[model samples]
Target: MPKLRLKESLAGLKKIKININFKKKEKQMPIPPPPPKPIPRGLKIIEKYPLYEPFSHVVIVQNPKTGEHQYILDELQLDPLERGVYDRILEILLAEIESPKEEILDPRKFFAESAKKIVDKYRISLGWLPDVSWYKILYHAERDLVGFGKIDPLMRDPNIEDISCDGVNKPVYVWHRNYESIETNLQFPADEILDNTVVKL
Candidate 1:
């Protein structure tokens, strides 16, 4: 009877050892690393300026996750006649201002002062209440005088390596920081506009 009891005890011990080994094997199995995270493509507005009242604007945008700048061309939505009038007004302003007689010491201050004078002149001489705000006037005039006008913001973006346009009614292309090359929403509707933009560049 004692011998039978010993044999039964040995069988129970073997069962316990087998269970422990199984648990050890399960723990030793390798676990996979989590899948790589996806890159974000959404853009956010970093800054903005009103270009024309109720219609056009200039905005500085960036990819929120990547911190990459994206150039935007916000155009005025107007009838051909109204747009023509505005263009003529802009041309007149540019012509009257003339080029600086000497090397400007402080371009920003000079442009700001000049823009204010121009706006004041329009109000007093022409009895014109420019539809745009004073700030908008300053932005446009300064861009034309000291910067590249419509393409100034694009030129200022460090992330854009190159800019190109195929022709009229085609979207402008830009070599972006993260996106490589991509088509921008901005487009030139006419050959003259494209030529003008190229001249500014």
Candidate 2:
């Protein structure tokens, strides 16, 4: 009778193990994958004007033709707080132009011409353009007063928030505080610097 009871107990243990294995296999479920991340609108600008070691203030411009963006540096190189002030001015200008009338102010033209005037006025104040032919003074003053290698006349304009040059003869890129970068629908050739100097002369 004792040996018969032992055999029954062993059989019960084997049956319980088999049931647990079957439930584990039957209850399994498939795992789903995670969702993908979204891309940022500003990434194109960021790529051109990459943030390097020293986090400088940057202005980004978009190309109208290709719908691409570029980045440039501001001449004043303001701190974060000052950049806020510049941004406010841009916001005001943009808001003013939202509903255009017959004579909407062309901000780009205004900024460019105004900046040139400031440079000319400065030259007069310094007596740098004295008696020299007006045309000669206008042409050379830019080179004489501002350093020739990298300086830009547009930098004088308060409205121009950023400027960049890949090479000479290349379309110099500008960031108007109110309007992002103006593409100019132009590009400088690979040897733009050499081409630009010859043309300027």
Candidate 3:
């Protein structure tokens, strides 16, 4: 009877050892979690201004996640005073350039002064106007014609095909999808003509 009891106890101990060994093997052969993914770099922002063109500006803000560069217009935050000053300068430029009354009574001074004031106050720098010139004024005038002209609300319309001026004696030509080409009897003198053509090209 004693020998049988001893044999039974030994059998139970052997079973316990086998179960512990199984658990140890399972722990040693653990399935590791997948390696973590790498983090991506952030987006890049770019702003560019076209030379010899007023208000022909571009602001590109890129998104790394979307892989797209968003072209932002009318995103510049300007104060009411700044907006008013800009509009007034534009009005003066338009009136002067369209009629071009006299060489001595040039509106370039007004444009330069107003633009300079805005730049100084707002600390805004134009890409083309690094060195202000009469040519820059002409460019701005044309831009205003395209952007704020009765035909187009200045930068508000993106469907304008072409804005062309042959000479002061000749008319300004605008190409439209519906009308094909329309001519307006707008004239400018030799100086204005040469200045506009040269700056635009």
Candidate 4:
């Protein structure tokens, strides 16, 4: 009798209805990058090798027309976002980086350690950056700070005894231990760039 009463009372209640809806937000996809341009006929790469593993490489090229050989230093290139991060990190390091404690301590090693800390601290502000970009910025920051700015790879190379730049828009020349003297593909495109190179050196 109680069970029948319960069923009769439940049947007295009205049926419930639910409205369900799902909406997805639209996302704008990134544009595809342009294809690489072809290498010009004037220059041809003879040999290529890594100078700093993933960060830097060296390319030897010769002009077929002039039979002139040149050395090119290929380093990791950062995009706009990565470049911005690199610039900011460098600015902070330049102001706050510590000097060597002892004369015997390697300045490069000390600076690199400090710079790594700064990079780690600054990375918090940079959200969703890829490792490639992060490493590119780090490499550039270290390159500009403790290491030689543009020609750090060349400096590391034991074969080259001397490096020289004549003037703006002129190729830098390196006195290779084996090849003697040869021009480098690195050239100062403008007067200010040449001045900056001098200051960096």
What local lDDT score does residue 42 receive in model 3, on the 0 to 100 scale? 69
- Cα lDDT, all candidates: 0.48, 0.34, 0.34, 0.59
Top-lDDT structure, candidate number: 4
Q: Write the per-residue lDDT of candidate 3 for residues 11-94, one digit (tens) a residue.
A: 111100000111111111122222222222464554433211233333334566765543323222223554454555555444
Query: Is candidate 2 or 4 superior in TM-score?
Result: 4
Higher-TM-score candidate of 1 and 4:
4
Models sorted by TM-score, best on top:
4, 1, 2, 3
Q: Which of the numbered candidates is closest to the native, going by highest TM-score?
A: 4
104-155 in candidate 2: lDDT tens per residue? 2442334334435554544443433223233222222222222121333343
Candidate 1 residue-wise lDDT at 9: 11
| Worst ten in a row by lDDT for model 4 | 1-10
Give lDDT tens digits, candidate 4, residues 1-201. Answer: 011000011122121111212222223223232222334578987777656666656777788888877777765577888777777777777777655444534555566567778778877875668766766676676666555566666766756777787666667778766566787766657665444445444
Worst 10 residues of 1 by lDDT: 14-23
Q: What does each candidate score in C-alpha RMSD?
A: 31.7, 33.7, 37.9, 28.0
Instruction: Give lDDT for model 3.
Output: 0.34
- State TM-scores per candidate: 0.51, 0.26, 0.25, 0.70
| Collision pairs in model 4 | none
Candidate 2 regions with alpha-carbon error over 4 angstroms: 1-135, 145-151, 184-201
